[model samples]
Target: MKIYTRTGDTGETGLFGGPRVRKDVLRVEAYGTADECNSAIGVARAAGPDPMLDAVLAEVQNQLFVVGADLASPNDSPYIPRVSATMTAFLEEQIDAMETELAPLQQFILPGGTTVAAYLHLARTICRRAERVVVSLAAEEAINPELLPYLNRLSDFLFVAARIANARAGVDDVPWRKP
Candidate 1:
């Protein structure tokens, strides 16, 4: 099928099992940000070739698609997978594993190091934005209860992953200095 479906030409998009909504709606915004986060993670993955990091990010990219689908479908859509606590736990597990390799944080750090680490930091920020948007969306509507926690944990995972990337690259995190 051609990429241009022309269905969204009227400024509205269809949900997985719900009616079309304007692209500017909170639900759309939340998923769009998730997509941005996913793409950022992809860039991070492409920036370097760490087998462990790449494996985790590959799983995360797939999960983010689930997140997007979950946000898009307002109704109970059998086809769309809902975010679950198990997924959040997976992120927590990864974070714990990665943190084992990182030095304890003594101070705030700037969001850059090796190219892969920098991209991971960028993805972390976008994940935070996606979390915020999801929060706002949740406040206004019923959402998967697991989603907020998942995004929250995912951001934390990204932060630690960035640190791990820097560690693997033999680069130190640039500590933030009070100016």
Candidate 2:
């Protein structure tokens, strides 16, 4: 199969169920941002985090693929698996576990520390953008209601994971300070 399909040259892309939406549409933007977040996570994983963090990131990367697939497929399609309460629950568990290992946060954190931490923070922001776009899309149409909660929890997971990465490496989180 040739890589260059040229099908989207007209700024239109196909969703899994049928209708072709404009490339710039909210649905497409939401999934595309998810893809971008996956790539950022890949970059962070490649930077060699601790074994546990690396494993968590690997799982999260797979889940992000599921997220992107869920976004790309039409809501009514039965062929695709949508995000579910189980998925979000697993993230919540991970977040809770990570929190137990770190000190309580007394202040807001800035997005910087170790390289892996920085990348995770960057991915968190991208996940937030994806979440926002998905929320906007949901407002305009029917959606797989679980998606919003999954993305919301995923961002929370990313934030804590980044902190854990920094803590494991003996790097302190850069806290925000009023100038």
lDDT of each: 0.93, 0.93
> Per-residue CA lDDT of candidate 1, range 129-149, in tens?
999998999899999999999
TM-score of model 2 vs. true structure: 0.96
> Per-candidate RMSD vs. true structure?
0.8, 1.0
User: Which 10 successive residues of model 2 have the least lDDT summed?
Assistant: 74-83
Tens-place lDDT per residue, model 2, 84-132, is 8999999999999999999999999999999999999999999999999
**lDDT at 142, model 2:** 77
Highest TM-score, which number? Answer: 1
